[model samples]
Target: MFNYHTLYAELLSSLHGSPLEKWLPLLPEQINQGLCEQRFGDLADWRQVLQQLPEVSANKIELKDKIQIDGDSSDNTRAQIKNLLQALIPWRKGPFFIHGTHIDTEWRSDWKWDRVLPHLAPLENRTILDVGCGSGYHCWRMLGEGASRIIGIDPSPRFVVQFYAVKHFIQGGYHGVPPVDVLPIGIEAVPQNLQAFDTTFSMGVFYHRRAPMDHLRELKATLRQGGQLVLETLLIEGGLGEVLVPEGRYAKMNNVWFLPTADTMISWMRKCGFKNPRLVDSATTTLQEQRQTEWMTYHSLEQFLDPADHRKTIEGHPAPLRGVFVAEV
Candidate 1:
C-alpha cells in the first residue's frame, strides 16, 4: 500500500491544540480517499518516482526569491534527480532548481507571486491556507516569507506526489520537518466555518466553481476575524453587475464558468461579508508567462489562444485577463 503516515501525522500534529484541532478527525480518511488507487490509477507509479529520487542533501535552500536547492552533487547524481522528476510531467506551477537541474515549469509562478506579494500583508508568523495550490510552489514561498504554518490543498493526485518529490529533498536537507505541506484534497474537504487561518489564498479557482458565492463564502469561512483573503482569477473588463458566463469553453478550459469584472468580483466579495475589498493588481497572462517547456511538454496559453488574434481565445472569448483582489473578514 502507498502509505503517507508521516505526512498525515505531520498535518495532524500541527493542528493539534491549535484552532484547527477540530480538523484532525476528518483528515486521515480524506487523505486516504484522495490517494486511493482506484481513484488515481497512476498513484503507484507516482509513488515509485518519489522513492526513486536520488538521496541528495541540499547544502543551501533558497525560497525567498525562487524554489532552489543547491547541493554538492556530481553530474551523474544531478542527471538521476532530473530523470525521476520528469515522470511527473505537465508541471504547471513552478520553476524549481534542484541541484544543477532547472525544472522550468509551464507557468512562471514566480512572476505571479511577484505581482501578488507586494499587496499582501506581511506573512511573518502567519498561518495560511492556499486553495488550488498546485504542487505547493507558493506554499514554500509563503514559508520563505516567515509564515508559521501553511497547508496547501489540491485534488490532483499527480500534484500531491509532485509536492512530496520536492519535499523529499527539502526535508532531507534539514534537521526537522518544515511547517508547510500539500494535502491531496479540495476546498470542500475543509471544515466549514473553521475560522482558523490568519490568511487564505484562493488563486485561479473562483471561476471554476459553479457557485461563485458559495466559493467566496467557503474562503471566508477559513479565515479568523480580521484575517485577509487574497484571490486571483480571470476577469473581463466591465462595470459592476457584468460577468462573462461562458456558454461552452474558455481558453480551451471546459470547467471555467464565470469571469467577472474586477468591480463585479469586489461586489461579490462584499456580498459574502468580506470587508475593505479592493483590486490590488490586474494583468493579462502572456505567452512568456505560461508556455510549453522542457519539463512541461504540453500545450499551454499559446495553444489555447487564437493564433490570428492574441486578444481572444480560440473559442472567441476574451483572453485570460487576471485580477488580484484582497479583502479582510
Candidate 2:
C-alpha cells in the first residue's frame, strides 16, 4: 500500500488551525473516495512502485527554475530509482530530476510557468489553490517563490502517486515536509464559497468544463475577497462574442467544450463579478513545448495537428492557441 493514512495525518496536523481548517473534517473521506481500488484498477500497481523506491537522502533540493534533487546515492541505487519511476509512465506535467534520472514529461510545463509567472501578483506568503494541478509540478514551483501554503486538486490517482514519489525525496532532503499537498480530488469536492486562498489558479482546465460560466464562478469562490485569479485556457482569434463550440473533437480531445476569444473570456469574467480582468499572455502552443518523450511515449501535439497544415488541427479547427488572464475577485 502507499500509506495514504500518513498523508491524511500530515494534512490534518498541518491544516488543523490554518485558514483552511474547515476542510480538515472532510478530507479523509474525500481522499478515500478518490483512491478507491475498485474505481482505479492500477492503483495497486502504482502503490507497489512507491513501496519499492530506493530510500536516498537528497543532498540538494532546487525548485526555483527546475525541480532538481541531487543526492549521493550509489550508481546502482540511482538506476533502481529510475526503473521504479519508469513504472509510472505517461508523465504529463514535469521534467523532474531525481538523484540522476530525468523524467521529462510530455508538456514542458516549465515554459507555461515562465509565461504566466511574470504577469501575476507576487506569490510570496500567499495561500494558493491550484485546480487541475497534474502531479503538483507548479505547486512545488509556487512553494519556491515563497508561498505560505499550496493545495493542488486533481482527480487522477496516477498523478497523485507521482506527486508523492517526488515528495518522498523532498521529505528526506529537507528539514521537514513543506506545507504543500496535492489532494486526489477535483475542484467540485471543495466546500463552496469558502473564500480562503489569496490566489486561485485554473490553468489548462477551462475548456474541459461543460458549463464555462460555472467554472469561472467556482474559481472565483475559492479566493478570498480581493484575491487574484490566474486563468489559462484555449482561445481562438476572433472578435468579442465569438466562441468556438467544436462540432467534434478539438485537437483529438473529445471532452473540450468551448474555445472562446480573449475578449469574450474577459467579458465573461466581468459578468461573474471579477474586477479589472485583462489578458496578460497569449501564444500558440508549439511542438517544442509539447512532444513525445521517452518517459511519455504517446501521441502528442504533433500527431494531433493536420499533416498538411500546422496551423490547423486534423479536424480543421484552429490549432491550440492558449491565453492567460489575470483578474481580482
Candidate 3:
C-alpha cells in the first residue's frame, strides 16, 4: 500500500511548496498544537506513527530485477534462492537450510517481503526477538529492513554462520537497519531482562520445541505494552484434529516437528496471553513439477499428497506440512 520511498517523497514535496501560504497551512491547528510540538517534535515522529498504523496499503512491492532463473528443478531452485539470498545480502557461502521444507517460491519470492512484511507492524525503534531462528532468515531480514535491535536464538551452531552469511554477501544487503546478534542457545537461555522487547517474531521454529507452552510464556515475557509477535509455521487443516506423534525422524530432514491445525495452534497462542491471534495466510502443498515449499524437499508433488500414502509410518506420513499458519501475540 504505502511505499516507504514514495511516502518519503511526499514529505519532501510538501516541505518545498510555496513558502508563505505553505508555512501558514503547515502550522499546527489549535487542538493539534500541543501534540505536534511536545509529543512529535517536528514532523518525523508524527510520520513514524503514521507509517506504523495497522493499515494494509498493498500486498505487492517492487524489487530491482535481479532474479535469474536457472531452471525449476529442486537443485536449480535451491541455487536460485541461494543466489537471491546472496543478492539480498552478502554471503561467502550459500544460505544454509532453515526449519521449513518450503524454501522455493511457491507462494512468495525469497526476496518478496511485501506479501508478509506489511501484515507485520514495524519495529524500527523497538527490540525484536526471534525464536528458533534457524540461520536467522527472518531475523536478518528484519535487521536489514530497520529494526532497532534483533536477537536471534537457535539451537544449532550453524545458525550463527547462516545468520550472518547473507549480510556478508549481498550488496546493500543490510539496508538501513541495525546489526543483529544471534545466540546459539535455545530461548530458555536468553537473559530474562532482555526478554522484554517491543516486538517478537518466531517462524518455523516453535512447533519443534518439546514444551510449546513454556516457550510461549518465554515469548510473552519478552513483549512490552502493545507489543506483537509474528509467528509462522507449518500447520494441519481440520479444526482440533489429532495431535500427530512422531515415532522417529525422517532420517534425512533433521528439523522436523509435529503439525498442529490452525485452531489448536491459535488456541495455544491465546493461552500464552496473546490477544487476537489470527492466521494471515494458509495453504497446503500439492503437485508441482517445479520445486514447492521448503517442506516438499524429500518428495515430489504427486508423492507428497498421494492419499494412498497417508499413514502413521515414517515414509508414508505425507510431507512435512499439510498447511501453514501465520499468527501473532
The model with the greater lDDT, 2 or 3, is: 2
Off by over 4 Å in 1: none
Error of 1 at 49 (Å): 0.7
Instruction: Estimate, for each residue in 1-329, the C-alpha lDDT of model 1 and write its tens digit.
Output: 45776666777887889999998898888888988888789998988898788788888998899999878888999889888888898788899998877889999999999999999999999999999999999999999999999999999999988998888888767768888888888999999999999999999999999999999999999999999999999999999999999998999889999899999999999999999999999999999999999888878999999999999999999999999999999
Local error of candidate 1 at 224, Å? 0.4
- Prediction 2 global C-alpha lDDT: 0.92
Can you write out model 2's per-residue Cα lDDT over 36-68, one digit (the tens) per residue?
A: 888899998998888888778988999988999
TM-score of 2: 0.98
Residue 247: error of model 1 in Å? Answer: 0.6
Residue runs of model 2 more than 4 Å from their true location after superposition: none
lDDT of each: 0.92, 0.92, 0.48
Give candidate 3 regions above 4 Å deviation. 1-115, 169-178, 193-195, 250-257, 285-314, 322-329
Among all windows of 10 consecutive residues in model 2, the one with the lowest summed lDDT is 1-10
